[model samples]
Each structure stands twice: as structure tokens, then as C-alpha cells.
Target chain A: METKELQEIASLLRFEAVRMVYEGGDGHPGPALSSADIVTALYFDILKIDPANPDWADRDRFILSKGHACPIWYAALNERGYFQPKVEHFHLRQLHSEFQGHPSMKNTRGIDMTTGSLGNGIAIGAGMAIAAKATGKDYYTYVICGDGELQEGLCWEGANMAAGRGLDNLIVFIDKNGYQSYKTVDYTVGRNNPAERFMAFGWDVQEIDGHNFDEIKAAVAAAKQNKGKPSCIVCNCVKGKGVSYMENNNNWHKGVPTKEQFALAARELRGISL
Target chain B: MRAFSGSREAFAAALLDMAEYDERVMVISADSLKAMRAVPFGEQYPNRYVECGIAEQCAVDVAAGMASCGLIPFVGTYCGFLTMRACEQLRTFIGYTHLNAKFVGFNAGLLGGEREGVTHQFYEDIGIVATMPGIQIFTPADPAQCYHAIRMAAEVEGPVYVRAGSGREVSVYGNDAPFATSGITVWKRYGTDALLLSNGFVLDRVLAAAELLSQREIHVTVADINILYGDDASEILREMAAANLVVTVEDHNINGGLGSYISKLACENRPVRVHRIALTSYGESGPANELADAYGFSPEAIAQAVAAARTQQ
Candidate 1:
């Protein structure tokens, strides 16, 4: 896929994610929008996934470690034909719907692990990578985490274990949107570059603009070429992107846009329709 | 019989046996190999063992991760820390996800480290874990039973919690004992004047009380309940309904342990009177025997509670 086509798909995903949040009356749209391009590039262009065979042993595994931003993930999965998208039942807790508040392996299709509590999905992804190596299967496991989620002690434990074991099949991406639930990353961890820190921890670090499809695809391709050590891609993204009213706003982390604002955001994403 | 041994030793031995047969068997410890007695397995299969170092929460979460990758991870930690300290991780990562992780909680039910006070004592671990959905809870009485239970838990799919007693050795089941996930075992048979139901290290005390009561013409029957969570209450209620009295003893808190479950089962099934003998509250620092006596968890206390209940009738 070309860079322009990927960018168009990402814009559509962002619009759908925001529309789902508005319709469902609850969601974390900021991180979802921030992660829209990366998820879109992976699902559409990069990942070797077959929607018909969700449990294909050699298929690439993607885990949303910061799982609250599941609207964009659901949008990608639905676009990739994993399941039908239900806009009305997106964020309802515990309902017998296609999507859950957090991804559940038991309830949702195409979800590898159920993740909501911070700092657990990466560990599970590491396990998947280790399992693939142990079982002699050729596959890669990709885990995406929030910049704020790095504050958890378990994430470092998992990172150290993955690096120490030389899990080349594993790749970690951090959505460095620079904000957490309560405050900004500067207020939380105080200006530590995630790529440099991961590189210090013995990872092959790649810093890229999260909204740029060409950069994301290139980094992902580079990560696959490198072997013998895990790769960490630090994606620099705005908290909320594309929509002018919600861009870089922390309040949209889990906020639902009003009906009027939702129409305006949809129009901005559509952009005069060719 | 292969001599008397503790549950921790049996668990370690069984884990080694599984590792010898299956390369996918992995054991992760929270720097408690000496405490959980997995040194033998670690010595033999160093590659399959992970020493996660003093963090029970991280230990359990790592085990869950390992399990997700198709390795059967046996997490070894003390009962107090594994259940209480890392409860959220256990509930979300393992229990809710129904992962294939076996959580072996050593020193359960105040059996070991009695002098370590309330910090080390875990009186409600079994009850607390039993409440979680899709968890199989097992409290073995002796070494042989622990061996069978551990092997079964590892081979079986889904999450399991094996609450093991301390180093106090006892001989109850022989090598021929059957160990199933949800089955209960009967220890001694009497004419059924009264029935004594027990689990964990207190099973020996219940047997001693039964022997004493039998000599005194009480004719008590003893049942060693290994599977406490979601036990077949119908069979127990039928047996209790026929008996003149039912007494339950355990080295655990009175609220959520075997005694509480028996009391609730008896009241709901039949209108039979039941007597409970267990620790009423938190324990103090003291020797094992002294704490057992102070907390009313000894054989003498079981006999007294039964005798007092009989007198009141």
C-alpha cells in the first residue's frame, strides 16, 4: 500500500473510532486517535494476519497493552473483516457484544488476551514470543503500550526479561503521547526519552512520528530485519489527532464527543470526499 | 506407604516428576525455593526453573505470561503473600482469563511459621481463592495425597490453587489413594454416632479426636476433605443428616474455611445441628503447638466442642 492510501485509511479509522465513542457514550478517544495510524498501518499493510483463521499459529500477534484505547483497535479489526462492527455496543461493560470495555479472549473474536489492568499485556506478549521460539514456530509478537504505562514496575521487569533472553521475535511500541490520566509525562516521569532508555536496556530503538504511515511502516520493516534482540519503537503522537477541537487535549482520553462536535470531527476527517 | 512426608516435599517431588516427562513444565518461584522445597527440581532442571526473587505479585504475573505461551507454569509462594499481596494480579491475569497456571501456596492455614505471627499466617486463603470463578482449590492432607494432587493439577487445564501445609508430617492416605480435582476422600469409618469433617494439617487432629471419641463409646466417623471449594455438599449433607451430630475442625479462620462451609451446607440442606472448631480471630506469636492450643485447633478442642454440643442437645 502507498503512503497516501495508508494515511486515508488511518483518517477513516480515527473518524470511526470517534464516532463509536460518541455513539457508545463512553471511550478513550484520545489514545485511540493517537494510535490510529500505527494500528492501521500494521493491520492493513504490515501484519501477516488472516481474519478467517484468527488462531493461525504462524500469524503475527498484536496485543494492546494499554487496552483502554480499544476503539481504534476494534475499528482496525472490523475493517480487516475479523468481525462485524457494532457502533452501538462498543464500550458497554459486560454486554454480550462483539467488543468489550477491554479485549477478552473468551468473549471477543480476534483478541489474543484480555487486558485492562496496566502492565500485564506486555508480559503476556513476551510469553507468546517465548512460546513461539520454544515451539519452533516462525512468528512475531507485537505489543503496544502507553507512555504513561511505563511507570508500572512490571513493564520494566518484562522488558528486562525479554532483552536478557534475546527474544528477537518480540517488538514493543510505545504511544508517546506525553500525557497520562492525571497529568503530562513531564509531570509524571520528568522528561526521560523512552527510546534512549529502551536502548540503554539493550533494545534496538526506533523513534518515529506515530501519525506518519511511511515512518511507521519503515520502522516495522526494519524491526523485522533485525534479529537477536527485541525492538522498541517509540511513536511520537499527539494525544488526540486529526480533529481540531480534540487534538492534544487530555480530557478526551476517555471523553465522549457531543453530537454536534462528532459531526464536525467526521466532516474534518472526510475532507470534501475526493 | 512411602513413609510420612510434608506437602511441600511432595509438591516438589511431583513437580520434578512432571518435568522429567514433559519439557513444557516450568516452575517459577518467588525466591522461596527453600521454603517451597523446590531445590531438588531446580537442581535437576535448571533451565525450566525461574527464580523471580521476593516479588509475589511479579512472580504470579510472570507465571501467567509463561502459561499464555503454552508452558505450564507452577508458581511457588507462601499462602499469605500469594493470595493477599498479589490478589488483583491473580484475579485479573490468571483467574479471570482462566489461564493454565498452578499457584502452589506453601505454608497454608497457620501450619508453619506459627511464631511468625499474623503476617505469615493465612487463615482465609483457601476461602478467598475459592470464591473466584473457574479456580480449582485443593488442600491435601498428607504427602501421598499432595503428590497425586500436584501431578493432576499440572496435567489438567485451567487455573488451580494448591494450599499446602507446613513441614508437619502426617500419614493418612496410602499410595493407592485416588486424587481427582473435585472428589472428596473418606479417612476412617465408624458406626456414625457422629461425623468429623476436616481438611489441611488439622486432619490429623480430627483423626486423633475420632480415635479418642471411639474409645469413649462415641463411634465417630472422620472424612479428609481434600477438595474444599465447590465440594459435593449433597453427599456430606446426606451423611450429616443421618448422624446425631457433625463437627468440623480446621486451622483457619472461622468465617470462610471448612467450618463455615459445613455450617452453611448443613443449615441449607437439613436442619441438623453442627459444631465448628477453628481460629476465631487473628493469631499471636507463639509456637505451633501453643498457637494451636490457644486458637482452639487441637484434638482436645475438637473433642471438647463436640462434647459440649452433645451436652447442649
Candidate 2:
């Protein structure tokens, strides 16, 4: 797919995600918006997955380890026809809905694993990669982790194991959206470079602009070309990308925008900033 | 299934059988390959065996990862480390996700103190995992039962936590010991004066105590329960109703174990006096017999508790 096409889909997804947060009256829009572009690239171009037969044994596995940012994931899955739903019409966090506040493998079809709690998806994703090796399957496992999610001790423990095992089949993309749940990742943990840590842990590391479609595609291509070790693409992202007021704003981490604010966010996503 | 010197070896034996029949069955150890007597399994199928090198949380999440795919991974490690250190990891990844995985917790109780010290021993494991839904808690009696329990756990579709003893656990059951995926087992039947309920390797002493009580004319009905939680309440409730009083014996802490579990049931359902004989404090490093004596779980101690149950009622 062309970069322009991917960018258009991503903008649509960002608007849809923000609208879900507004309609649901509760959600983390910051994460959802931040992860939109890369999420779009994976669902639209990168991932080798069959939407009709989601349980295919050889499907490339994708785990949203930073699960709170799942509105973007849901929008992409809905757009890719993983399930029957008009992406703009469905309730976001409704009770018993397939698309819960966070992703649940038991509930959703395209969801490879359940995640809401931080630091779990990466480790679980590593396991899936190891499984690919065990079964001699060509399917790669992609994991999207939050930079703030790195504060969890288990993430490092998992990284060490995956690196030691030389899980070249695994590719981790750190959504470096600066702001975390409470504050900025740099302010909360002191040191901010997730790429350096991944390098120290022996993973093949790369840094890229998360919202850039070309950067995401190139980074993924480089990750696949590289061998013998796992890859970590630290994606520098705005907390709320594309939207005028919400971009780089931490207050949007978990909130529903007003009618006027929501209208403005939607317009900005359509390249009609007014 | 033949009994080995310990429950861990017997469990490993059963794991080997599981792996032989099913190509997807694998072992994930936290640097306890030698401790679990799984060096043989590792040697036989190096591709299937994953040694995470002393990280319990890492091993468990990795096993969850493998389970998410088509593989069934058995994680072998110390009970406390697996239960305490990686409690959240187990609850979220394996428990809430309802993954098809088996956790073989070695050094389950104060009896594990004989191996190392209190650090290796875990008396609070049953209590901890009992709260997590979808996790089947199997506290098998001995090596023979551990063998069957591991086999049964492998058959379970979701998360199953089978607690095993350290390498020195004595085999009380015969080669063909009866094991349940979920239910209680009657180890012996003398009378309904008292129901002797116990789980884990301490069942050896519990059976002996039942024998001594029978000889003393204090006749009690002894039962060994493998499923600590998530059992059909009817059979156990029937056994509880048959007895005048229930005597709980285990090599675990006084709270959150068989004693506490049964007491909760008895208090709510049956009108019977409950007598608990379990570890009162953290485990002490010593010989198994001495630790048993010190913690009030010796054969004589269990028998005396049964005898004294008449006064409590």
C-alpha cells in the first residue's frame, strides 16, 4: 500500500477512535490516537493474517501489550473485516461487547491474546515467537508495547529471556508516546531511552517516527531482513497525534471530549483543521 | 505409574509420557532442571525444554506465550517463587487469559523445608491460587498420585496448578493410585466419628494417624482430597455430614489451606466441630520428621487431635 493511502486510513482510524471515546464516555484516547498510524500499517499492509479464518495455525501473531490503547486496534480490526461491525457505529466499552475497554482473546476474533495489565503482552508475544520456532512455522510475532509500560519489571525479565533465546522471529515496537497514565515516561522513570535498553539486552534496535507511515513500513522491513536476534523499533509518537488540541496533551490520556472538542478532533483528522 | 524417590521425579515421568504421545507438550523450567529431575527430559527433547534461568515470572509468562499458540507447556519451579513473586503474572497471563498450561509447583509446604530452608518451602500457595478463577488446584498426596495428577492436569483444557513435594516425598499410594481431575478420594474408612481430611505429602502421616486412631478405638473416616478448590461440593459435603467432627491435617500454614478451606465449608453448611492441625509459623529448616513433629503434623499429633475432637464437640 502507498504511504498516502496508509495515512488516509490512519486519519480515519484516529477520528473513529476519538469518537468511540466520546460515545463510550470513557477511554484512553491518548494511547488510541498515538498508536493509530502503526496500527493501520500492520492491519492494512504488514500483517499476514486471514480475517475470515483468524485461528489459522500459521497466521502471524500480533499482541497489543499496551492494551489500553485498544480503540485503535479495534478500529483496524473492524476495518480489516475481522468481525462484522461498522467501526463508527459500535459502542466502545459497553458491557458484554466483543470490543471491551481492553482486548480479550476469548471475546474478540482477531485478538491473539488478552491484555489490559501492562508488561504482559511483550512476554506473551515472545512466547508466540518461540512457538513459531518450535513448530517450524514461518509466521512472525509482532508486539506493540508502551514506553511507559517499560516501567514494569516483568518487561525487562521477558526481554532478557527472549534475547537469550535469540528469538529473531519476534519484533517489538515501543510506542514512545512520552506521556504515561499519570505523567510523562521520562518524568516517571527518570531515563527515557527504551532503544538503548533494548540494545543492551541484545535486541537489534531501531528508532523511528511512529506516526510516519514510511518510517513504520521501512522499520518493519528492516526488522524482517535482520536475523539472529529479536528486533525493537522504538517509535517516537505524540500522545494524541493528528488532532490539534489533543496532540502531545496528557489530559487526553483518559477522557471524553465535549461536543465542540469532539467536532474539532474529527475535522483535524480529515485534514480540515478549522 | 511407578513411584519414584520424590513427587517431582514422578511428575517428570508423567510429563515425559505426555510429551511422548503429544508432540506439542513441552517443559519450561526456571533454572530448576536438576531440582525437578528434568535434566533427562531436557536431554531427550532439548527443543521442547525451555530453561529461563531462575526467573519465575519470566518462565510463567513464556509458558503462557507457548500456551497461547498450540503448545502445552508445563512450568516447574518452587511454589513460593511461582505463587508469591509471579502472583500477578499467573493471575493475569495464565489465570484470567485461561491459557492451556500446567504449573507443577515443587516444595509445596513446610515439608519442602527439608530440602533447603523456609525460602524454598511454600505453605501459602494453595491459598493464593485458590482465589484465582479457572485455575484448578491439585494438591496430590505422594509421588504415585503426583504422577497421575500431572497426567490429569495435562488433560485439562485450561490452567491447572498441580502442587508436588520436594525430591524426598515418600510414596504412600500403590502403583495404581486413584487420581481425580476434580473430587475427593476416600483413603480409608473406619467410622464416622471424625473425618480426617488432608492433602499433599502429609497424607502419609495422615493415613498413619488414621490407622493409630482406629487401633485406639477412636475410629475415624480418612479421606485424601486432591482438588483443594473447584470440586463438586456434594460428595465432600456428604462426607462432612457423615462425621460428628472434621479433623484437618496438612503440612501447610494454618490459614488458606485445606484446614481453612474445609472449615469455611463446614461453618457455612455442616454443623460440625472443626479441628485443624497445621503449621503455626513459617517453616523451619530441619529433617522432615522433626519438622513434622515441631509443626504438629506428626502421625501421633494427627491421631491425638482426632482423639481430642470428642471434647471439642
Candidate 3:
């Protein structure tokens, strides 16, 4: 797919993800919006997956280490025809729905690991990459983590292990949106460079504009071709991309849009369509 | 059952055998392979083994992740660390996620490094794991049973918690000894005057108790209640109705172990007088046999509890 097509799909995914959250009345829309483009590129262009054969042994595995952004993942999966997009099931925690507050492996299709507790996804992705290498399976493992979740000790544990083991098949993307659940990245953890940090951990690091399809594709390609070391793509993203009212706003971290706000956000996201 | 061996060795060999047959079999350890007797499997399949180095939480989450990618992950760790230390991750990642991960809790019950004191002894592990929904809890009676249980765990889907006892040379079952996940085994039956239900390390002692009771014309029925998760209500109730008394035994605390489950079963179903023989409190540093005696988990202790219960009536 062309760069323009990927961006358009990302916009569509962003619009759908926001709409799902708005309609579902609860979710982490900010992270979902922040990660929309990368998720779009991976699901549409990078990953070697058959939506029909979700359990395909040779298919590339994707783990949403920041699982709270599952609204976006579910939207992408729905768009990819993994299942019929049931917008109603979004944010259905403990309600026996496929779309839970966190990404659950049992409830959803295309969800490789059920992750809500942060810092767990990277370790799991490393395990997957190791398994692939051990079993001689030609498949890559991609893990998308929150910038704030980088504070977790386990991520570094996995990062160290992955680099030490030389799991070149594993690729980690840090959504470097400068905001956390409570405050901005600077206010919360004080100036920390994800790229340099990952580089120090022996990962081949690349800093990219998360929303830019070309940059994401190039970085992903580089990661896939790279050998002997795990790759880290530090993506600079807006907390709430496309929605002016919510963009870069900390309040929208997990707050559901009101009916009026939802309408306005939807109209703005869809442009002339609404 | 033809795979007659010691429990720890049998579990290790069975895991290796499973890994040899299935490339997806992966074992993660918290630097306790020698203690867990998983060194053989680790040596045989180096790529399949992960040494997580004393991090139980990492071991659990990593296993959950490995299991997510179609790998049959057996997390080998001391029962105390696996249960008490990294329990939340186990509940969330393994139990809640329903991953195909088996937690091989080595040195379960008072069978752990008993000389290391209360911290290493995992007397409450079975009770804790059994409470988690969707996790199949297994406690193999002997080495032969452990082999079958480990093999069967691989075939069974979803998360499994196998409480592996330490290398204590208890009486091994015959070569023909059969095992199943949900079924309780009747190890010995002597006219059903009373039913002595037990699991794991307490099985031999319960058998001994039943044998001793038989000489006193008590005619006790000894049951190896290996499956400790569910109530085993129907089986217990039937035995309670048939027998004059119901006595439960375990190398665990009286609060939530096999005895508690059997007591609940007896109370709800048959309404019989139930006698529980188990550890009443945390243990101290000593030999396993001495600790068992101090904590009232010895064969004589179980027998005396049953005799006392019988005499009360």
C-alpha cells in the first residue's frame, strides 16, 4: 500500500476507534489515538497475518503492551475482518464481551496476549521471539509499549534479556506520547529519552514520527532486516491525535466523551462525512 | 503408570519427554532447576529452557507470554515463591488469561526445604491455587502418578498447577497405577467404617492410618484425593453415607486445603461428622518428618485424629 493509503486507513482506524470509545462510553482514547497510525501500518502492511487463520504458527505476533488502548486494536481487527465490528462491546469489563477494558487473549481474535498490567507485553514478545528462533519459525514479534509504561522494571528486564540473547526477530515500539495517566511525561518521570535508553540497553534504536506512514514503514522494514540485536522504534505521537478538543489533553487519558462531545469529535474526525 | 519412578524425577523426565515429542514445550525456571529436578529437561533441551534467576513474577509473566505464542510453558519454581511471591501475576496472566501454562510448583507442602523454616514451606499453595478459577490443580500421589499427571497436563488445555513434592522416597505406586485429572483414586478400602481422604505427601500417611485403623477393626477406606480443586462432593458424600465417619488429611493448613473442601462437601451433601488432620499453623526449622510431627501431619497423627473422631461417636 502507498503512504497516502496507509495514512487514510490510519485516519479511518482513528475515527472508528474514537467512535467506539464514544459510543461504548468508556476507554483509553488518548493512547488509542496516539497509536492509531502505527497500528494501522502494522496490521495493514507490516504483519504477515491471515485474519482467518489467527492461530497460524508462522504469522507475525503483535502484543499491545499498553493493553488499555485495546479500543484501537479492536477497531483495527474489526476493520481487518477478524470479526464483525461490534462497537457496542467496547470497554465491556467483566461483561462477557470480546472487547474488555484491557486486551484479553481469550475474549478477542488477533490478541496474542491478555495484557493490562504494564511491562508484561515486552517480556511476552521476547518469549515469542525466542520461541520462534528456537523452533526455527520465520516470524517476527512486535510489541507496542506506552512511553509511561517504560517506567516499569520488567520492561527493562525483558529489554536486557532480549538484547543479551540477540533476539533480532523481536521489534519493540515505544509510543512516546509525552503524557501518562496522571500527568505529562516531564512532570511524571522527568526528561527521559526512550531511544538513548533503549540504545544503552543494546537495542538498535530508531526515532520516528508515529503518525507518519513513511517513517513507520521505513523503521519497520529496517527492524525486520536488522540482525543480531532487537530493534526499538521510539514513536513521537500526540496523546489524542485528530480530535482537537481531546488532543494533547491529559483528561482524555481514559475519560469517555460525553454525547455532545462525542458528536463534535466524530464530526471533526469524519470531516464532511458526518 | 508403567513409567514407575520418583515424583520429582518422574516430573522432570516427563517434561523432557513431552518437550522431545513437542517442540512447543518450553520450561521457565526461577534458578531452581536442580531443586525442582528440571535440570535433566533443561540439559536435554537448552533452547526450550529459560533460567529467569529467582524472579518468580518474571517467570510467571514470561510463561504466560510464551504460552500465548503456542508454547506449552511449564514454570518450574519453588512452591513458596511461585505461590506467595508471584501469586498476583499467576492469577492475572495465567489463571485469568487461561493460558496453556503449567506451574510446576516444586517442593510443595511441608516437603520443601523444611530446614529453611516457614518461608520455604508451601503448605498453603494447593489451597491458594485451587481457589483460582479455570486453573486445573493437580497433586500427584507418587512418582508413577507424577509421570502420568505431567504427561496428561500437556494434553489438557488451559492453565494447570501441578504441586510437585520434593525428592522424598515415599512408597511408589505399582507399574499399573493409573491417573486422571478430575477423578479421585481409592487407594485402599477396608469395609468402609470411615473414609480417609488425602492428597500429595499426605497420601502415604493416610494409607498408613487406614491400615492401622483396619487392625483395630475400624475398617477405614483410604482415598487419594489427588484432584483438590473441586468439592469431590459426590464421591465424598457417597463415602460419608456408606462409612461410619469421614476423616480428611493433608500436609496443608486446615483453612483452605483438601480437608476444608472435604468438610464443605460433607456438610453440604451428607451432613456427616468430619475430622480434619492438617497443619494448624506456620512451620518451624526442622527435618520434614519432625516438622510433620510437630505440625501434626504424621501418619500417627492422622490415625490418632481419626481414632479420636471415631471414639467421640
Give residue A163's error in model 2 in angstroms: 0.9
Per-candidate Cα lDDT values, in order, are 0.80, 0.86, 0.81
- Cα lDDT of candidate 2 equals 0.86
Docking class of 1: medium
Candidate 3 accuracy as lDDT: 0.81
Candidate with the larger TM-score of 1 and 2: 2
Q: Per-residue lDDT for B1-313 in model 3, tens only?
A: 2243567778787887777668888888878788777787788788888877666777787788788777898887788789888788889888898888888887777755578887787788877887789888888877777787888788889988888777663855764466654457777878667788887876777777777777778788888877765534465456567866778887778878787887777666667778888777787888877877777767777778888898897
- Candidates' TM-scores? 0.92, 0.97, 0.92
Off by over 4 Å in 3: A84-96, B1-5, B180-182, B211-217, B230-237
Ranking by DockQ: 2, 3, 1
A85-155: candidate 2 lDDT, tens digit per residue: 55556587898777788888888888988889899767787889889999999999999999999999889
Residue B276 of model 1, lDDT score: 78
Locate the minimum summed-lDDT window of 10 residues in model 1 chain B: B1-10
Candidates 1 and 3, the one with greater DockQ: 3
Q: Which stretches of candidate 1 lie over 4 Å from their true place?
A: A84-94, A189-193, A196-204, A222-229, A272-274, B1-5, B180-182, B284-287
TM-score of chain B of each: 0.93, 0.96, 0.93
